[model samples]
Structures are given as C-alpha cells and as structure tokens.
Target chain A: MPNDTLLETRPVPGTDKTTAVAVRTHALSKEFGGRLVLHSLDFRVEPGELVAVVGKSGCGKSTLLRLICGLEKPSSGWVEVGGERLSGLSRHARLMFQDAALLPWKSVKANVVLAAPRNGRRDRAAEDALEHVGLRDRAHEWPSILSGGQRQRVALARALASDADLLLFDEPLGALDALTRLEMQALIERLWLERRFSAILVTHDVEEAVALADRILLMDGGRVTFETVVALERPRDRASAEFTSLKEAILERILGRRS
Target chain B: MATESLSYRSRLINLAGPWLVPLGLLIAWQIFSGSGLIPRRILPSPLEVMQAGFHLTLTGEMPMHLWESFQRAIVGLMIGGSIGFVFGLLNGLVGPANVLFDSSLQMLRNIPHLAMIPLVILWFGIGEPAKLFLIEIGVFFPMYVNTIHGIRSTDPKLIEMGRIYGLSPWQLLITVVLPSALPSVLVGLRYALGIMWVTLIVAETIACTNGIGYMTMNAREFLQTDIVLVGILLYALLGKLADTITRALEAWLLRWNPAYR
Candidate 1:
C-alpha cells in the first residue's frame, strides 16, 4: 500500500515547510435530510495546484467546498488532507465565503489577527498578510467602512494570516463589479503564485476559471461532468487565442447543459 | 466678516434648537399661572416647583431621598441584570437549558411585574426588600429577553467561519458571538433602565419610608403641591439622565458600527 509512502513524504519540517498539502476524496457524497446534494464522486487536487470547479448554481459546488473544509461532513465516503482522513474541521485548510463575512465590530487588522495561529507572532503575521493584499494601510479601519472589494481583500488577508496549506474559495468574487472582479482575479493569481497553496476555487464565471486555475472541473447534476487542462502560461492574456478558445469551450458546455 | 457672523449665528441656532420647545412651554406655564387662569394648587408654576426643590435641597431632605432612590436603582439593576445575563447566555447557547427554562421565563414575563405589588408586599412586608424585588423583576425580563435574542440572532455564517478559523468554544463566544450580540444587549439595557425607574416609582409610592416616591407622597399629604411637582420633575430628570448615560455607553462600545458613528 502507498499508505507508508504517504507518511514518509509528509512535508517534513526543515525541508520545504511551505509545501502545500494534497486533497483527495473517495466517492464522496452528501445528503441533506433525504435529498442528496453531492453524488458519489471522486476528486483530487495535487499539492500547490490551483483547481477551479465551475457549474450552474445549486449544482453542489459550494457543498463540495464546505465538505472539503470539513465544515460539513460527507454522508458517505471520505476525504483525505495530506494523507490523513478529515474527521472534523480541517486543520490545514481555510475557506473564504462569497460575502466577506467579517465581524463588523472588529477592525480589519483585528479580524485578520483573530485567524492567525496563537503564536506570539500573530500581530506580525496579521500585518504581513494585510501587506500581501495591499490593505496594510486600512488595517486599523472598521470592515463596515471598507468598500466591497476592500472588504474582500481583508477577508483574503484573514485567510492568508492563518498560513493554512489548502485554501477553499466559494465564489469569492461573485458579488463584485466587473472591474473589481478583474482586479481581485489578478490579486488572487499573484497570491496563489507567491504562496503556492493548494486552492480549489468554485466559481460560475468561466473567464475567471481560465484566468486562474491550472485545471478546470465542470460540475452538473451533483457530479463533475468534464475536465479541462488549461496548459496556459501565467498572467494569462484573455485576448490570446488559447485563452479565448478554452473559455469558450467551457462556457459552451455549461450553456449547452442548461439548454 | 459677514460670512464669519453668519456662521456664528448658525452655530448659536444649533445650540438653542433643542431648547426651543421646552422654553416656550415653560413661558406659557408661567404666564397662565401668573394670570390666575389655573389655581396654583392644581398645577404649580415652574418657579414654585424650583423653589420647593431648592428649599428641600437646603434642608438635606431632597439629597437623602435622591440618594436612596439612586442606590436602589443601581443595586436592583446589577443583581437582576447579572442573573438575567447568566440565564440568557445559558439558554441561548445551550440547547437543553433553552428547552428547560425558556417557556417558563416567557410565561413569567407576560405577567405585569408592577401588578405583583400586592403579592410582593405580602411576601416581603413593605420593606426595602419589597421595593428592590419589584425593581429587580422589572429590569430582569428586558435583560433576559434581549440577551437571548441577541445571542440567537448571531449570524450562523460567522459562527461557521469562527470554527474554521480554529477558535475555541470560549474564544468563539467572546470574539464572535458576544460582540455580535452586544448591540442588541445594549438596547435591552436602555429599556431596562427606563423600567428600573418606573418600577421604583410605583413600588416606593405604594409602600416605602425613603426614596423620591415617598417624598412625593409626603408632599401630597401635606398639600404641598409645589413639592409634588418637584418630585415629578425630578423623576423626569432622572429618566433623562439614565437615557443619556446608556446612549453614551452604546456609542462607545459600538464605535465600529457606522450607524453609531
């Protein structure tokens, strides 16, 4: 069994401490009451990979992210993060919601600090994370006073402050205007590149998937129906032929399924 | 120079705006009483009420009654408020506690606390305990209802986020749950302060040796209508003071809330 091998290559300390953790699900399924939201489907994300799951609303994309983060349990089958099974909330993963979901009572910096591990260095870590999102100057301000994009940036900073190996994003830019969405996409891409954390981004926007993910999974009827490898270079040019074709292909599939 | 004077006049109007209505009413009151249109016994003029207040203050009687009333209010609030808070925290956060106690408390809350005066007197025999009991009961329900409502109304998404972020149960309560519930809790506190004075007024008037209510009763028996007016005005002033303090508290604690800002 590769179980022994899984133990040996477990991102040993003093050797690539920033090495991202792998996520795997074995025939994972989730049922709410008597209704099944996610079918018995298998999925995986390689260490340091940026994978996007695109689908129509209510196709269980958000459910999958919640399950992976261990916020909700699978009704059947199981999930493994970095080789071990996810029993409760995942210790190595951070999930960001569509809404900024900030505590209105806390300042931006305090919200980020609240997520950082209780090492004595939490303040420093919060500052650094805020710096990464270019919100360091606004750290002392309340989340209420921030613009939607700025609030999302603070949320991103909060996730980064935790230093988790896996990041789960559920339509993080779904509410932003087009210009803000494009800026957030670039910001997310840059952060993913810098941190190299394993990310599973569930989005409805095909162009967003093309601009960010290394690979894309098309989900429908509570199952991943198709997969596409972008094989495109970083800082993807949306006007380029390869980028346009890939985006169009995925968009057509989603539209075709809808019809 | 013209612009500066205009700005100065606007600033003066801003300062005087809130006092305009009360000042007009006071003038009307004084003129009507001076013209003898209404007997002084029926409605004492503002000047007579002020003079009575001054005389009582010089004799140290007003301060003594004021202190008694103030002490009762604060003590009742602290004791009742703390118990209500504990019960609320327990019922709101713990399922079994809610199942066991919530219905009973809700039923008790429906019974008008002031209406229990006869029963309270029988239980505690017209002592400080009886008055305190009434005030405590009056303040308790607001605190209890609001604390639980505040806690129950906490956004579930934030709780989920807190759990994912590795917050311990206690940390979640302090950092996420409590802070979110605070605005509601303060609203409850403001309501409770108003209730505190009301309960004390009724309880003291019904049966008590000391306090503002007793002073008013004593003035009525002696046919000192001006002193009676003074007592009524004192209660109004105290109520206003309590509201102002609570408003300041809310402003300071909810400073991050844009509405408060």
Candidate 2:
C-alpha cells in the first residue's frame, strides 16, 4: 500500500508532508437497487499515471470514476487518495464534465477562481491556468457567450487549476465537434505532459483511449476484461499501421469478451 | 450601431405587441359609444373613463386609495415571500426537513386560499391584519413550491464537482445551489407578486375602507361606470409594473444564462 509508503516520499508538492499512494481502490463495488454496477473492482493508479477507461455503454466506467472521485459512495470498498480516506474527507480532486458545468452566474475568471485560493498567488494561478487552456482572453466573459469549444476549455481550466494531484474526466470532450475534438485532445496531451498528475479518463472512444493513455483499462459487464498498455512513442502517428493494429487488437478484445 | 438599430426595431415591436388588443378594443368601444350602438351608461365612452382616470390621479382621493391597497399588498408580499423563501430553502437543502413538511404542506395548499376570507375576518376581525393575512396566503404557496423545485432541480454532477473540490456544505449552497435555484426562485417571486396584487383586491373589497378595490366597489354602488373603469385600468397598470420590474431584475441576475444571451 501506497498509504504505508507515503511517508517514504517526502517534500510532496502542494502539501507540507508527503503521501505514499496517489489513489488506491480495493474491491470497490457499486450497485443500484440490487442490479450490479461494479463488482470487486480493485485498481491502483500511480502518482502520475494517465489511464484511459474504455467500455461499452452502461458498463459502469463512469460509475467507477464517480466512486473514485467520491461523487457516489461505494457499496462495500474503500478509495483512498494520497494516503487520505475519501468518504469523510471530500477528496480535493476536480472533474471536467461533458456539459462544462461552469456556473452560469459567474464570469470565466470567477469560475476558474472558484477552486483556487483567495489571494495574489491564487489569482496568478487562475490566470496561468486560463492561459494554459488558451482562454486567457475570455477570462472576463460570461460562459453563456463563449463557443462550445471555448466553454469546454474553461471547464478544463477549472479542473487543471485544482491543487489536487488527481483528476477524474468523465467523457469531457464527447460533445465537441470533430475538428475541435482533435485540437482539445492535443491540448489535453500537452497539459498532461506539463502537469504531472494522476488522470483517470473515462471515455467511450477507442481511438481516444489509444491516443492518450499510458495504460488503457477495457471494462465489460462492470468488470475489467482486459488491460492494454501502449508501447508506442509519444505523439504517436494515428494512421500508422502499428497504431491501427493496436486499435484492432483492443476492438477484438472488446468484441470477443462476453460476460 | 448596426446591431443596435436592428435591436431597436425589435424592441419597438415587442413593446407594441401587448397594446394591439387594448388599442383595437379602445377604438371599437369609442365607436360603439359615440354612434349610440351601445348605450352610454352600458359601455361608457373611453373618453369618459380617461377623464375619470385623469381626475382620479389629479385629485388626492384615488391616489390615496391606490396607496392604501399598494401598502397592504406589499406588506403581505414581504412577509409571505420571506416565509416561503425560508421554507423553500429548507425543503431544498435538507432531505429530512423537506420530508417533515412537504406532504402536510402540500395537502394544506390544496384548500382554496380565497375561501379563507370569512375565517380570516372572524379570527383577526375587520382590521388590516385580516386582509393582509388573506393576501399573504395567496403569495406563500407558489413561492414555496418554486423554491423547492428550484433547489431540488440543481444538477447533481456539478454538485459532485463541488464536493470533489472539497467545498463545505455552506460553500456548496452559496456557490452551486443558489445559482442553480435562482431562475426558479425569481419565477416564483414574479408569480407571487402578481397574485399578491390580485388577492389585495379581494381582501380590500371585503373589508377595507379605501383602496383601488374599495374605489371600484364604491363606483359600482353609485352606478359610476367611469370610476370602475379607471380602477380596473389602475389594477392592470400596477400588475404590469410589478411584472416588468421582476423581468428586469431576472435579466440582471441571470445575465450569464444562455436564454438571456
């Protein structure tokens, strides 16, 4: 356990002390009205591992994200982040929603500042995050006035601005147009390289998982059916035969596996 | 400047929309009365009503009556709306609290609030309190329902985001819940305000000595159709004024909403 190992790694960023494990889940099970959603789900996300979760519709991938993020309580397991229990202490991570969940009453800057400190450093952080997301110019505008892509950028900024070491993305770019989606995916990859944080991305797109994840967890019938690790280099060619073969392999595994 | 000109034209059209029916009715009424198609006493000329309206405003009597009714309605609205807002917030944020009051309150809300007139007067006498109570009852329910609906209707995903960000419950309420609930709450308030004015007339007619409602009642007794017409016009004016203010305030508060954009 990372919880026991946290003391060994000192001088933790954003904390005076250090933590062993960034995130740990043990036999995490979730059910709704006796219908099994997630069963005996045990997973460990390293301090800065970027994992993509791919699954068919209604396969409990989003539910796993929710459980990890503490949005929904687990039926019979524990989720700990950076050596702290999640149930009592609302985990200080951030989630980027498909809807961009920006409070419609606040300006872009205010929305970004919502999770930041209330001082000079916080202001600088928010400004830097917006700049990083390419929304610095739209910081003062209402979210309602922004384009769909711009709004998603702001939502991404809000998540990235959080001091937490973990980020749970629940199909944050599923609603974007194709052209914008490419730009966003590249930007997200760039951001991930710059900011080393554990990210668990829940998405339906096989290509998205292959393109972004260091390791992809393929879930079927509320269980991890296959675990795939991309050995391809960074900025990997999407059209390369190797990439196509990998995608095909994952697809076959997805199609072949039956509950 | 280009967009502004187009917007100005649209603004004029919007303003003119509501007046079309009233303006046509006015022309029809004037022609009917002037041509003796309808008896003067029966239809009453628009000119006569206008004259009466002018006289009532120019003199202190009608103004005083309007002020009295306005005062009663506003006071009841303030009290009733405050109660409704508190209950609504409680019902929204606290599950057990909502369960405690929701069903019983819902049952009580079904009774005709207007029919409480005799009982209100019996308990509180013919004083201002009785009339105010009646109007307050009218204002409470709509505001309460809207409050609960607004609060409960908040997006769970956003709320989860707040929690994941380590937001305290109070922080959650102020940041996420209030903004989400605002549109509904404002709508409820507008409905409550309109009903307050309506209930004022009923209460005033039953008990009060001087008000717009009392003025209309007095005019009916004296067979002065012109005065009655003036009172009705004043009621319409006040109701429209209240609605316009609420609409403007809603625009100001929810400026970030895409519907407004």
Candidate 3:
C-alpha cells in the first residue's frame, strides 16, 4: 500500500534540538465486558509533533485517546508519557473534548484557572492563556453566555493554562460550523506552532488531519492500519495540489482502497 | 418611543394586578359591614381585624408570638437541614451508605410526618422539645430527598472532566457536584419552609401557650374572630416572606445558570 514510502522526510521547524519522546504506548489493548474495543497496538509521539488519528465511528480512536490520557485503564499493556509509566491521569498531559466541557458555574478565566496548578503566578498564567486564545475580554463572563465557538476557545485556553507537555484533542472542533471550524483549525495550528507541545488529535475529518498534523494514522477494527506523514509546510495552502493529494491519500486509506 | 410607553403601561398593570382583587375585597367588606347587613359578632369587619392587629402589635403581644415561632422554625430548619444535607451527600457519593441508609430513609419518608405527632408528644411531652421535634421531622424529608436527587443526578460528563482536570474529591464536590445539585436543593428548602409553618401551626394549636398558632386558638375560644383572622393573615404573610427570601437566594446563587437568566 506504499505506506513505508509515504513517510514525510521534511524537517519540523524549531523542533530539531529535542530528541525527547513525549508518548510511547506498547501493545495497548482495552476491552469492555469481554468485547474488545482497542487491539494491542504500539505507538510513539515525539516531542513537538502534531499527530492525527483518523477513523470511522466505533473504530477505537476515542478509546486510544482515553487510554493515552489515562482516563481509561488498559485491559493489558502499558503507556509511557515523558519517559515515565502512567498510573492514573498524567500530570504532563491535557485533553480537549468535542463538548468544550467548561464548568458552567465558573467564569471563563476561572475555568482556565481550575486546570492550572496552584502557584503565586497562577492567575497571570491563566490570563496569558486566555489572551493566547483571544478570549481575554471574556475572562469574567459565565460559560453560558459564550457562543459555541467562544466556549471551545475557552476550552482551548484551559488546556493551554494547564501547561502540560502533551495535549490530546478528541474531535475538539467537530461541533463547530464550517467557518468556525476553519478559524479553530488556524488557531490550533498557531498555538501548537508557538508552544511546540506534542499533540495527538483524533478526528473523523480527513482534510482536518492533513491541515493540522505532521503525521496521520488511520485506525480500523481496533488497530492502526495505515500511516502517512504530511510533507507540507506550515500555514499550508488548502487549495494547493500537495494538500489535496495528501487529503486524497488519507481518504483512500479510510475508504479501504489500496492506493 | 410609542412601543416603550406601551410596554411601560403594561408593566404598571402587571405590578398592580395582584393587589387589585385583595383591595377590592377589603373595600367591599368595609362597605357591607358599615351598612350593618351582617352582625358584627358573627363576622367582624376588615377594619376590626386591622385594629386588632395594630393593637396587638403595639402591645408587643404579636411580636412575642412571632419571635417565638421564628426562633423555632430557624432552629428546626438549621438542625434538620444540616442532617439531611450530610446524609444526602454521604448516600449519593458512597455506595455502602446508599445501600445502608437510602431504602430505610425512603420507607420512613412515605409515612406522614403529621401522623407521628401523637407519638412524638408521647416521647417528648407537650413542651419545646415536642414542637421542635415535629418541625424537624416535617423539614427533614424534603431536604434529604432533594439533596440525594441533586447529587445523584449530577452530569457524569462534568464529573469525568473534573477527574481529567485533576480536581481533588473535595474540589469536585464544591465545584461541580454541589452547584449542579443546588437548584434541586433550593426547591427542597422552599418545600421544607412551607412544611415548617404547617407543622408548627398544628403543634401550637394542639398544646402550645405561645406563637401565632396559640394566639389563633385562644381567640377562637372567646369568639374574637377578628383576632383569629389577623393570626391567619400573619401566617400567610410569613409564608410569603419565606418564599421570597428563598427565591432571592436561589437567584443569587444560581446566577451563572443560563436557565435562570
């Protein structure tokens, strides 16, 4: 399927110095009530890499994210983050969900602060994170008053405020409209570029994976079935031939075509 | 500008609507009683009720009854509400607690609290303890049921998020679980307030020598129906005041809730 030949050889800008591995999963598997949801799989994410996992519904993408984030225990096998084995939720990693999940009782800034570690400069860090997501003015407003897009932005700010070394996105932009999705994609790209934190985004949208990731993995029947790397440059042109071809290649793998 | 004026006029009418009927009834009673169609002994006029209320207030008799009743209600509410809250939290969060206490409490809840009065009196006698016991029993069930429901019905997604964010168990209760359960808890509190007055009235009428209930009972013996009416009015006013205060508290605490806004 030309999978080995498709690995992008392009050097990631501003990330050459760090040889640190951010995440490593060895033969991970999960089952619920005797039915297997995630098959034994080996995976690794290098520091500052943005990896995308794409698959259809019920294909174990979300389960993989949950396991990596320590929200779910593996039925067997182990996960290592920042070179240490994870027991429960890893302090080095943060997760963003599709639902935003901001505490409705708290103000936007307080929601961000809730994820931040206690310190003298905690509020300053939260404010900076909110400013990064362009939500500085909305810091004191309740989550209920925010629009769906704005709420997601606040959720992004919350992840940023956490200051975790790795970020997991579980279809965080799946609920946005077309225009908002594009805006969020750009914002996510900008933030990932600036912070250089390792990120793994699990999404159903093939074009989004091409637009945002350094590499993309396709999962099916509870295992990674296809892998490809995006060779395009940052601020990638969606209308460019490379972008379309890359998206087409991922789509073919997802659709079960051996191209 | 015209629409603004129209809305203003409608707002005024809305504000005045509730009072109009009561005012009309008062005026009609005064006119009819002044004409002497009905004997004053059978039904004292509204003026007589007001005068009795005013005279009682000036003599400090009404204040004494009111103060005694208020103290009892507050003490009972504080004791019963606190116990209910703690039990609810325990049962809702811990599986063993739920298994041990929930069913027993539910079974006990089904029995009418008023039905326990004679037993309560026998156990505690016709003193302050008996009256307090009745009020406590009356208020406890609603608070307990509501707190359990509130804690149990908290959104699982939010709790999951709290775990992911590394919130401690206490933080989770304070931030997510408690706030989510607040509306239901407030509803329970309002319900308990109504029951408190009802229970107190029954307890006082049966035996007490103080409180508005005792005053009403005393007036009934001498056929001082005006004073009796005044006592009833005082109960209605107190109940309304409690409801208003509870509503205001609910609004302030739940200001972040979109449904309230």
Candidate 4:
C-alpha cells in the first residue's frame, strides 16, 4: 500500500495563516446494538482540505461521516473539531445528504434561509447562497418543481448559507444521473475552491473521489486501510493519464478486496 | 364544419360538465313527482321543496335556524378541534404522552360518537350543552387521529437535516415537523367537518328547540314534507360548503406540494 499520509498540519494553499485543524478523531469507534460498525481508528482533516472517503456499502463510510458531524456518538474515542472536544452535535459542522432533504413546504430560498445564522441578515445570506449555486431565479419556486440536480444545488446552498467551518457530505451526488452528476461535481469543486470550507465527502465512486478530494481514504472492514493524496492541479482532466491511473488504482483496490 | 361542431359540443360539455348529473336527476325527479307517480306527503316535488325554502327564507325563519345551527357547529368545532390539536401534538412528539393516551384514545375512537348521545343528554339535558357535547365528541377523534398520523409521517431525514443546521427543538417543530404534517392535518379537519354536521343533525332532531334539525322535526309533526325536504337539502348544501372551504384551505396551505398545486 502506498501510504501518502505525509501532508499534516499544512497551511491551506491560498490562505496565508496556518489555521486550526478542521476535524480530528482519536481512535474513534461506533457500535449499534452490539454490532460494531466502525472500528477504532484515528483520522484528521485540515482546514480547507477536501477529504473523500470511498468504500463499499456498509463499510462504515457513512458512519464515519455521521460521527464526524456528531450525529452519532463514538462508542469509545472522542471527536474534536477546531481542537475542541465535541460533546454533542457539532455547532460548527453542516451536513448535506444524498437525498437533498429540502423542506417540501418551504420555497427554495426559505429553505436556504432556515439554515442561515440567526444573528446575520438571513434574507441576504439566503440570496447570496442561492446566487452562488446559480439558483437566484428559483428562490421563490417550490423544491418539488426542481430537478434532482437542482434540489441538490439548493441543498448545497442551504449548507453554504450556514457559515459552518466543516461540511460533511454523505454521498450528496449519488442519486443524480451521469450528466447531472458531472455538472454537480464541477459546481461542488468551484464552490469548494471559492469558499474553502473543510469538506469530508463519503462516496462509493472512486472517480468522484479522484476528481474532488484533496486526500482519498479507502475504508474496508470498518478501517481506513489505504490513504493517498490527489496531487493533481485544479480543473483536473478526467481523460488525463494521471487521473485515469489514479482512479483505476483505487477501483482495483476496492474491487480487489471483494474477491 | 364537422370538426367545428364537435369542438363547440366539447366546449359546452366543459362548461356544464359538473352540473350534468345533478341537472338530469333534478329533471327526472320533477317529472316523476309532477306526474303523481309518488305520494306528495312522502316525498314532495323538488319545486315544492324550493318553495318551502323560499317561504322560510322570506319569513327569515330559515335564516334564524341556519344561524343557530351554524353557531353551534362553529363553537363546538373550535373547542374540540383545539383540544384534539393540542393532545395530538403532545402524543405525537412525546413518547410518554403517546404511551399514556394513544391506546386509550384509539379505544374511545372505536365506539361510535353518536352512541354517546343518550349519555350526553342525561349529563347535560336537552340544553345547548348537550348539543355542543355531541358535536365536540364527533369532531374530536378525526382531528386527533389525523394529527398524530401527520406528525408521525414527518420524514426523519428532514428532522436530521434541521438539527444539523442548528435549528432548536421549537424551530424544528415549527419549520420541519408542522409543515410536514399540514396535509394530513387538513384531511382530518375535512373529516371532522363531516362529523360535526352529522352530530348536530341527530342532536337537534332528538332534543333541541332550534336549528335545521329541529325545523325538520317540527315539519314532521305538521306533515309538511316539503319543509322536511328543504331541511335535508340544507344539510347537504352546508356539508358541501364545508368541504369546499376545507379544500381551499388545503390548496392555500399546501401550495408548495405538487399534488395540491
């Protein structure tokens, strides 16, 4: 296994200051009804880093994201955000799910505004977030009328509206069709580049991992068994040899373990 | 010319589509009653019923009875509906409240609310309270059951999303849970409206001195079948009106829902 866990505590590329760590888990483990789902493990995410966790279903990828977001408690170890131990649901973390769980009763902008920080100008925040997702015109439309991709965009805008430092994505694009998936991937990358919130995306698609992640973690049997950093430049070419090779290597590792 | 005539026919059907069945029935009824196929004392002609309605309306007698019935239904509905709403909210959101109330309420719901009429009369006599109590019992269950169903039907995913977004418990109930429950709640309200009229009719006919039901019973004593038919038609019309109002409420509240839209 090529272990490239060397990048640690590094300052984000565009930012000048060495920011605090976005998330850190010390021997984190979780079990449900005496069934161990996530084994004891250590994990870290740097500020502004986009970490993608790719694994087969039920391999604890979703559980890892849930634990990081404090939706689930660690059965053994503790999770830290910004170097502070998390006691409950992380106030600093925002989560986006695969279903784009927008409130069906609220307008698109109202849905976004519901997540806006209370102390700020919520309406303006909602407008800015919708504008970022290119959904300014759809602010007044019901979520039910939007396409699947557009709903996810609104969900993204909602997460963005809340000025959280960490964003946990649980297979946010898994439900979209191929073309829409590509468009969403580009949009996510552009937004991540612009905002630079530390993001942990749990996905099954290795290509998506290669395309979007700063570092890719492969989990099998409830443990992070392989780690690699994507050193590719911005606007990475999927057709390029480096991208294909990296994608193939990860797919092989995942499928290789299945047999 | 053929296509144009067909289009004209279709346009006319579109204009009169909803009235066609009722109009046909009315015409057939008029012919049968006017031709003396049925005894006038048993089932009066539609025209006679209309005349009775007009006479009652002109004398302001019908309006007074309608006002009394309307006032009773509205007051009973307000009290019963609020009680059901509060209880349903508690039972739906709180585990202990559900455990304490759900099964008992379900048991009570199985018994016909009309069956409690004798007991209600015994408790409150033939006064306004007796009529009000019957309407309250009739209206309570549908609202309670539907409210619980609505709250329980709320998508768990949306609640999780709300929490992750830092919505307080109160905010979650207001923004996510309540909106999710609105459609089901509206359905309950419509069902309750039906029960309200049914209860009032029975109570007024058996005991009350005023209301549409009392007017029908009074007409029975005088053998004025026309007035009786008028009262029956009034109930049907009021029921339809209640349904329309409930539907409009659904459309307004659930405009975001594609089904309602």
Best by lDDT: 1
TM per candidate comes to 0.95, 0.90, 0.94, 0.94
Q: What is the per-candidate TM-score for chain B? A: 0.95, 0.93, 0.97, 0.95
Note each model's CA RMSD in angstroms. Answer: 3.8, 4.4, 4.9, 4.5
Higher-ranked by TM-score: 1 or 3: 1
Residue A61 error, candidate 3, Å? 0.8
Q: For model 1, how does the per-residue alpha-carbon lDDT over B135-208 read when each residue is reduced to its tens digit?
A: 88998999999999999999999999999999999999999999988998898898899899999899889878
Per-residue alpha-carbon lDDT of candidate 3 for residues A7-86, written as tens digits (9 for 90 to 100): 34332432222232489999999998998988998999998899999999889999998999899999999999999998
Which run of 10 residues does model 3 chain B get worst, by summed lDDT? Answer: B34-43
- Specify the highest-TM-score model's number: 1
Q: Is the docking of candidate 4 incorrect, acceptable, medium or high quality?
A: medium
Residue pairs with backbone atoms closer than 3 Å in model 3 (clashes): none
Q: Against the unseen true structure, what C-alpha lDDT does each candidate score? A: 0.92, 0.84, 0.89, 0.90
The stretch of ten residues in a row with the least summed lDDT in candidate 1 chain B is B34-43
Docking class of 1: medium
Native-referenced Cα lDDT, model 4:
0.90
Please provide, for model 2 over B146-172, each residue's C-alpha lDDT reduced to its tens digit, 9 standing for 90 to 100.
999999999987887677666789999
Clashes of each: 0, 2, 0, 0
Instruction: Flag the better candidate by DockQ, 2 or 4.
Output: 4
Cα displacement (Å) at residue B72, model 1: 0.6
